[model samples]
Target chain A: MALSAVRAPKIQLRQVRKVFDAHEQGMVALQNVDLDVSANEFVTLVGASGCGKSTLLRIIGGLEYATRGDVLIDGHGVLGPGSDRAMVFQHYSLYPWLRVMENIKFSRRLQANRGELTSSEVEAASGRADALLNVMGLSNAADKYPNQLSGGMQQRVAIARALLPRPQVLLMDEPFGALDAQTREVMHDLILHVFKLERATIVFVTHDVEEAIYLGQRVVLMAPRPGRIDTIYRVPLPAQRHQDMKHAPEFLALKREILQRIRETSGMKTDLELLEKLSHSVSISSLRTQG
Target chain B: MHNFSFSRPARRPAWFAVRGQIGRREYWMLALVGLVVPLLLWWSLSASGLVTKVFMPGPADVWNRAVLWFREDDLLGDIGISVYRVVAAWGLSALIAIPLGLAIGTYRPVQALLEPLTDFIRYMPAVAFIPLVMLWIGITEGSKIAIIWIGTFFQMVLMVAEDVRRVPMAQIETAQTMGARRSEIVSLVLLPAAKPAILDTLRVTMGWAWTYLVVAELVAANSGLGYAILRAQRFLQTDKIFAGIIIIGLIGLLLDQLFRALHRKAFPWLYLR
Candidate 1:
């Protein structure tokens, strides 16, 4: 009985490395990443551009392969994309030809094809889809095409589509990046509310420090060019959060900590000076060897 | 944020309500110019006696001959035969070309294998293929349809294949992530996404079908519009020849309009270029 007492993490990544051959440049995207996401926990990855947070999320989603390590979902080796994991892309990649209801029901139909569910089971799934549409405040626009909706409404539909499969892990790569600031804030709140309601484990990647602090249970900061975990902060906040909490002491402290870590890892100071020197210099190849 | 302002509604003019319902002003002006300038020039040339009336008949003479042909002979039958050839050849071309194009488009090895042959056939003038078609299926309706098919099929194949191939990789990946099988991806995602492009190619290829019809009927026994023109040419009836030419232009324009209407009905999503 004791041997059967163990519970696996929803997602686990160990010693993962990813490399790309960008023609002449040998690009190292991620190196030796070790992470564990508990069931129903919300985690966020934050860094500047090129820090490979999105790449890491893709590896977890089984959309990309790691050159050197292991990615396991519920104790099984992640090989290809599965219904157990769903991703929300930044570009709102809903099929233009399909209406909002059909987009939401797509994954469910695929799951039905795998013999995981019967016709009656699919009918139940459709009911749940209707409920999700209501939760996302898109019940009125269920018959509209993606192009007919606003950017915020489109993203809401994208979220609904991702949640339809009822995946154990929801991987979002800056899902609100295209929305305006006011809409982004609203979407962030909506997402947190949905997470609490569904109790689904989420791995969200973003470059905004405040957003990471606002939405993450644990914020993981990554360094660039061979991206690795720079720091992890456990956010102390109530389960139900509001805009007022963002002005609280705890929120500001976490924001400052994340911003400082990002500054340290960004290489901005040295890069700026080098860029300034390059702009002024006519020929820098000879000057490089002496330096 | 800026404050919102409110204004009183202005009284509408009667002409303002009817503005969009009427034909565009520029189109009417162009039509007037088109009619007057051509007629005036024709009358001036005829009165001036620059060219003889036997070789280049006036528009009035052509119109009179068109009326006579309609009244005396079965001109409608000729129109019907030409329409049949166009529809049959185009329908057959769609059946053969769309699937073949999809196959070549989706599979890299197939594309590579077929690309050389595709390019060769696409560039080789369709008129050049008429002699071989005549030799193979000589002077029959089969040969005429074959010529039209040969002319349109290659262009359809290239256009449809390129359209299918150009489907966004992101869309495919999205489908894959949803656990769609290979066939499901092709049918549900690839086919629907390529529908607009395929319809566009079909519209363009319809015009090519009409062009091939003229060449196909040139060698034939005696039926379609092309044969009527050929019969007129034998007697040197300049008015009859002009009438046939006008009918061909009008039919081509009508077919183009029909395709335009179908395009609007089928794919209202695609913005017209």
Candidate 2:
């Protein structure tokens, strides 16, 4: 299969830029971003809100287009959404009206309609869905609606739905940002397990730096105000890293280093400093008037 | 481990927990108050003889007429006819509205083309169309069904379209990323996400369909409950008219109850609140 041997970077984004005309505000979501993910690489983009981490992931997923630059999936110029990629959204965007099993079967039916597979092949895909449900520990809730499941379980279903098509690249946008602390930990473990099992190149976007450190092979930290990558750190830990690794001295040092870089580029002091200077000038003006 | 013993006597069930009772005590009490207050006022008016029975019939007279209608099966037949019309009209409307609604909802071009026409039709009263429909389809079952369908179809389209549009953008994006075609997106994401809303619209439009029955039967038709009421009105038979009104009220109540039951059965999680 020469198609399999082409050795394409599973996804590549070259000098991507995104601009949003939101409520009369000219917001540059991403700027001059160049990134690539190899096959089975676990990449994470983490930043403050409006940093365009999610925008960049959406571009790679073909959900949104960049104003400049190009997105390529396996050497093909990304046009629109393609089956080579699958995305899981933050709010557990499972169809509430469908049972878990039906939701999983949806992508398979789509594949069948595309003439990519026969009826029996589609049935095998459905069988894979059953197997995925079992793997995700949602076999009992297979018949239940999205509303009936807890936040964690719903996200599990969302992940399962994304994996149903066996996409080469998985794009996730803060998929666990809604869960509580304990559930988030469990979901992190579950995601790591599935990522290993599926061997799909994944680009996960989140605001949680600790989550990026724990999950990503490379943590790409982004900065806002014309969003661009601030730093990209290749995690030196072994592939089978655990939660306890977060407590290690080396891990803490890396975390502190990344945190320092984030704070430097954060531009957090501009607004407050401007306000203080303005207040001082205003007081001086009042004093001069009194004098 | 320490063991503590503090046992209390078993308590009786709360008011709502009782089973196999015809009605709750509060319901009976409310019913009593309702009956007695109205009866006392009516009896007082009747006893004063401020109005004669010939002109203003007493409650007893109306009750007797109701009993007579019930005994003669006229009330039941009227109720049956009204139910038949509402169900048939709504069924036909659903058959036409849902597919068309889905189409218009899924395709922007179709939606833009049909939106103004739908908006114009929605504001036009079903009753206002009675004369025109009578002329076009004549005073027959066809005209009545057509009027009811017209009354319901516009509202159904609007509701289903709104539901379809309300399908989350993220879901559609997710499906598209997984390589779903436009038609597949409609079936898998748009339709399923819009299911509860569409069902709710169908249920609501059932009531609207019933509301059109009187106008639909305004022609030379002779059998429906609406026609029966019209005949009663022409002859000044107020008692039969009142009976017909009561039958309509009861049937509407039953239809609403049926809708609620169906909603709960189909969408049990939606009723968790």
Candidate 3:
């Protein structure tokens, strides 16, 4: 059995503190947050809104700069937005102007443009893009623009684009948050399939505890009010996850326990308020759909 | 968690339905109504003789004058001259405006330095510049072209800047995350992303170019449609004045339609939703 527990840490965050300057005072988005993720490990950060889970993910992705402390990738100080880390936002951040195949190709070309490729390399890259599209079940819609795609399809293309350069770390902020229940189920299976296919470290942030436990080998529970990790739970599920496993008594037991822990970690009033604010920030349709 | 519904019921009236999309048939019918209603009003007023022909020429009188202008006089020559001047001046304005607007929009320091000045200048009507332009350029074709350019350039700059600002921040960040250099981001992401709206800005400002043409040819010109209108006004050739007005409207409509068609062809994906 290949276990990630014994592996060396691929990503190390040392006392990361982020304080956003408000008008008169500062808001602490993360307070001395420290986390270490091993290579090929799938870690999911679960919490109610405003727990700074997304902020933590963004810091790791280099989309944001932390006010204090260091983020190190492979024992090196993190630089801003390199090709080594790729992100999939909750909002389908696919380029609206580019077609699916072109979007994947463009992001890949930008990252991997170490001078012109030989014709064979170009052929291989095209083959990989096509294979990714097939895995995402978007082969038929390759020529369509992002605007023409459904929400699930758009997110799939976004994930494909993020995967094009074969990034070492994949940061996803609720990648399937906007999808319907059926689509989300399919996406979960698709994501699990992709996880099995590749051996990259993934950090996923979501509000759903069940999803966190389902997708991750280790689930990190976060709490708001100066956001910090409350606890990290090692999943006891089988090495290979299945849809049927969600209904298993062990899975349900873990899901219920995590739900109770999350509920108590952040009190109801703040959680409800955060949910309201988040719903208003994004479309209500995304929040209304149960995932 | 199950206590409340996510969506609230709309309080819209039963008769007032809202929808984002309209069918092609309905669109054409609405367009037909737009043209037909105005023509109906003109036909009714003219046929009823509510106003005298001298004061308000009927469609027939205007039509007769139009035929005479195109067939007998140097009307086509005047039309050609006005078109050429507008195309030249407007083209020159775009040449300067697009790049300058891009720089102003992309960098806040550039905007801070120039936006206030442009904001002040654009408010001053292009018509107010006629005397000064005539003084500087001495009533040459340069003076006429200067009229359209001055009237359009500043306003276009502000509009292009605004459209540039409206480019999605998410798109830019995405491009950056994809390892695009700053210059590459500007060229591949920002410029192409801002294109459709900039084209729209150009379309809107070109209409202003037409309005300023009358003021442009005010600089002692003996040839444009504006000059013809002025000459007709002096002789009290009311029909010729009306005919010139009709010509301006027709030409403006033609130019607007051509721009719209070209825009559609260029950015088909932009119109999907």
Candidate 4:
């Protein structure tokens, strides 16, 4: 953090605010959000649904503009989505018509269409896509269509496609939110491995607290109802991480603290609290007698 | 088998159960029944003499007339001409509509300009345009093709546009974040994503074109199946009329099957088990 103060942060969000005019009142999706992601940093935004974490990420990706404030990358204001950033959405983002290998090379096709790539560059991009396919453990499924692959494999292909452009920033919105527990763990590790290898800054969004803590170097907790950042916690663990670290004391403490804070911020009643309220209103025996 | 069962729910029969699917063998059996039952009903009704044969010819009489038409008359030529008119007009409409639909669906400006006009034009029935088509293109093969075009083109453009628009927002947004331009998004993202659906739209509109065939051939045409049917109607050649109508129905069914086969071949991903 001290070093980033001297060197400019890779990305800067200064008082970013977004108001969606979907309702008559003009719903405030995000407000007063300021964040700095250092080069190669992995930041995760965690909150309940409607917290504007995803919307914030979209703003950074230039998919949506902030209703107020600035989004800067390398200290330059974002005009629109550029080649400098790539995003992997939760699911169904891969072009179903393109095969795995072809999907991975899709970015290059976009560049070629703009007359930005030479024939040699195109060939090199193809070779690099094959390498990415291997990295994602998707070499065997290279020739298959996305619909033919499992949800996990399709996400891997999406990640491979996003990484091909080698953008400075990678934004992911609950990339594993749809997977089973085991598959989610596998994806967590795979993404971290890719993050380290690619040396690109990542901003991940998830409602999964464990995911936010495990994958993020710093966890930014957000709150709903005119969404805004509540707190940012720096992970106390070492740089190199493993699955076992998730169960470590510091990790558990952070997780518990964040979970409690999220409940408070979102004003959601816990299961115990909800049950207590219900029991006070009516007893199980009363319903049994009626039955 | 522990005998823990109390009351067992009745199993749903495959044919009528909600969302139930049958194997290929069962499907073929059901399909054969579907076809034969309709034919049998028609035959039994005609044989019962509930309706005069002049209006509803017996299956045997129609079959004999069809055989005679094929062997003795220029039925082959008529079939060939009719098929050519539908294919040519529909093909022409497709060549324009597919791209125009893609444009209208992809760009708001294109949609604003073309969609309302196309919608308005489509509601004006193709049959109603016979007088205008005759006046504009004159009483020739061109007018027949024009009539078919008038029938199919406007509706096709709107359907194609709808197909393109139905492509998920995520696909386009993913492309955008990957540095795809507006035009690139259409060609690279929307076009390929909508291809399977666009093909489906084409298949449905091809059916529409066939429905318009008789309307199209109602103009100063003298060679096609529609022409043969009309001439048979004028002379009260009821059996020959039955033959013509049956032949057209068979041809339309064949075309529909060909489209399905093509869709399966071209978009194998859509049919993944």
Instruction: Say which candidate scores most in TM-score.
Output: 4
Which has the greatest lDDT? 4
Q: Evaluate every candidate with DockQ and list the scores.
A: 0.32, 0.47, 0.47, 0.72
lDDT of 1 by residue, B12-103 (tens): 33444545444479568877899799878977777777889788888888888988888887888888998898889999999988998998
Model 2 segments more than 4 A misplaced: A1-8, A20-27, A112-127, A253-266, A270-291, B1-60, B70-77, B234-236, B267-273
Interface RMSD value for candidate 3, one decimal?
Answer: 1.8
User: How would you encode candidate 3's per-residue C-alpha lDDT over A1-291 as one tens digit per residue?
Assistant: 235424548899999999989746899999989999988999999986788999999899888899999998887778787778888888737777788899888765664565657778788889999999999999999999989988999889988988887888999989898899998988888888898887889999988888899899999998888898888999999868988999999889989888877777777545677788777867766666854
Q: In model 1, what is the error at residue A20, expressed in angstroms?
A: 3.8
lDDT of 2 at B224: 74
For each candidate, the alpha-carbon lDDT, in order, equals 0.84, 0.83, 0.86, 0.91
Worst 10 residues of 1 chain A by lDDT: A1-10
Model 4: per-residue Cα lDDT over A1-291, one tens digit each: 666555998899999999999999999999999999998999999997899999999999999999889899988899888878999999879999888898998899888878999999998998899889999999899999999999999999999999999999999999999999999999999999998899999999999999999999999999999799999999988878899998899999999999998888877557577678779768876878899
Q: Candidate 4's interface RMSD, please?
A: 0.9
Query: Candidates 1 and 4: which is better by DockQ?
Result: 4
User: Tens-digit lDDT track for model 3 on B154-259?
Assistant: 9999999998888877677667677778887778887888898999899888888888888888788989998898888888888899889889988988999998
Question: The CA-based lDDT of model 2 is what?
Answer: 0.83
Candidate 1 clashing pairs, residues 3+ apart or interchain: none
Clashing pairs in 2: none
Off by over 4 Å in 4: A1-6, A22-24, A118-120, A269-291, B1-17
